[model samples]
Target: MIWNLGSINADNFYDLPHLPGPGETLTATRFRQGLGGKGANMSVAAARAGARVMHIGATGADGRWAAQRLFEYGVDIPHVAEVDSATGHANIHIDPQGENSIVIFAGANADIDEQMIGAALSEARPGDTLLLQNETSGQVYAAKTAKALGLRLIYAAAPFSAAAVAAILEDIDILVLNAVEAGQLHAATGRELDALPVGDVIVTLGSDGCKWISNTARTTRLFPAFPVVPVDTTGAGDTFTGYLASALDRSLPMPQAITLASRAGALMVTRRGTADVIPDLREVQDHDFG
Candidate 1:
């Protein structure tokens, strides 16, 4: 089972000819709304990849539909509480090149408390996976609880926070971060990539691929990205993280899990949209990487 202490967001996407410059106002050619948030997206991705996923997060009454949507994707959401605050949301501006600039408002996502986290984690057993992101509150508590419970803690260090990462670093079993985030983390810690204290670190390179640094083996391996023409790179990283976690939970080896995750991420960028467009396991399996 995979327990996600994550965020749920109402993603608002605007398609524009080009990203707006500072103080520049431009009209978007199209606008669409969908389910999003790193936590929500990864939960959906894990479910679609055939893992038993439980999403532990909060959403506002107005965002109840977002929680309901997770049901359709096969994510268990008994721990998702409806709070008094507005639903968290993102305003995403996508340019013709498939690059995007985003502004996030953490509303109900910031309302996660220790009580909620404890209640959700109580259902998890030892050896189950606990996944976390920086989008929501209670991460430190979640990390501590998961550690005490003997769960395998996986941290996706996104929207990078030095304090947050430092607080949970000792508790995390596997650490995943994208290239830019890795750079920032390196800057914050004043350590080389391989010298981090974590046992396993995976750094994702957008087009080039991913790098795996195994502290246990004292070795690093590079896994190349599957080639694809990207339409919108919005949720590719989340898709990769979700699939990777699911693969790991199923007892797949690190190399195999990374290969499958690379496929899922490559497939994600071929389409548009966020959580709505994540590829299912069958779609990924049928994809001809050749």
Candidate 2:
């Protein structure tokens, strides 16, 4: 199983022709609701990519229904918990340029505890992969426990929290980040990207593609994408991370895993919502890498 410990939320999206400037409010072109949250979106993405993904997250009364959404994408929910508090949610505003601003209510997400990790870890075994991003509490706890249990741990250093990155870097098996995040780590030390000590680091460069660096290996590559006029890009990053996890579970090498992941990321750009955008494996196989 590919275990994901993170947040779950129902996304409320407002579509506007353009982003609103400061002190300016524009009428929205459209709006809709979808199942999202980096955790949930990636959970679905991993599942769709053929990994048996189990999401460990907290939900509230009204938001309990949101957990069912993951089932639709074939993600396992044996670890999903529903508490008495209100569920967390995101109010997302997306412009035609595919950029977005999100206001989050971290209700149930902020309330996660170590007990949740303990419960989830009870069923895990060695060789399973535990994937984590910065969406919940107990990341270090999860990493340490997964390592102790002989499970491989993959970390996506996102949301750029300095304290959190410092807290969890040593325990990660593979460290993944974007260019800005890679710059953040490099700037703090005034060293080269490869100087940072980690098993592996992936710096995703959007259209320029992603670079993979390790102590023994370093290379950059691009994935094939369709000639897409992106409509929304809210979940592209999550898709990449999720697909990468799926590929890794299949024992694909780093290069092949990233190629598949990049294709998945590109496919996500052609859609409107995070949950609604993930493409299946067959679509990626037939996709032109031009």
Candidate 3:
């Protein structure tokens, strides 16, 4: 089982001709709302990829539907608490090319606390998988607790925070990052990707591919991305992370797991929306990377 301590968001998408510049006003071409949040997306993605996923987080009463949506997507949400704050939401603006800019309002996602985390971790056993991202609070506490419990911890450093990474770096087993985020971390820590004190580090390069650096093996290898025309790049990384976590949880070798994850990410960019659109394991396996 995979335990995910993450945020749930109502993603509000606005279709624009181009990303709006500062102080610029432009009419939107279209609009839609869907389930999203770095944590929620990964949870759905991991669950869809065949892992028994348990999502631990808080949502507001107004956002009850999002939690229900997660349950419908195959994630176990018995630990998801309904808090007093409003549910979190994201304002996402997308261009014709599927490039996006987003602003987030962290409401109940920020209300997560030690008690919630402790209660959730108590339900997990040793060797269970734990997935975390920067969208929610109590990550450090959760990471440390999960580590002590002998869980295999995977961290998706979206909305990357160097301080947060530093606080829990020792507890993480796998670290996932985008190209830009990887650079930011390197610059902040003054260490190369392979030098980071973690078991494995994954740097995802959009379209080009991803790099896997293993500290234990002292090796770094590149896994090429599958070629596909992209419509919405949003959540592609989350799809990759979630699928990778699922593959890892199943004990697939790194190369095979990355191949599966690459296929999922390739498929993800071909669609729009976030958690709602993550492909299932069968879809990923059946997808022709060619």
| Greater-lDDT candidate between 2 and 3 | 3
Clashes of 3: 0
Supply the TM-score for candidate 2. Answer: 0.89
Task: Name the best candidate (by lDDT).
Answer: 1
Better of 1 and 2 by lDDT: 1
Q: Which ten contiguous residues of candidate 1 have the minimum total lDDT?
A: 190-199
Report lDDT (CA) for all predictions.
0.94, 0.82, 0.92
* lDDT leaderboard ranking: 1, 3, 2
Tens-place lDDT digits, model 1, residues 85-144? 999999999999878899999999999999999999998999899999999999999999
Better of 1 and 3 by TM-score: 1
Instruction: State the lDDT of candidate 2 residue by residue for 52-116, as single tens digits.
Output: 99898889988867898888789988788887777888888888877888888877877777899
The candidate, 2 or 3, that scores higher on TM-score is 3
What's the count of clashing pairs in each model shown? Answer: 0, 1, 0
What's model 1's TM-score? 0.94
In model 1, the Cα lDDT at residue 129 comes to 97
Which residue pairs does candidate 1 place in steric collision? none
- Superposed Cα deviation of residue 199, candidate 2 (Å): 1.2
In terms of TM-score, which candidate is strongest? 1
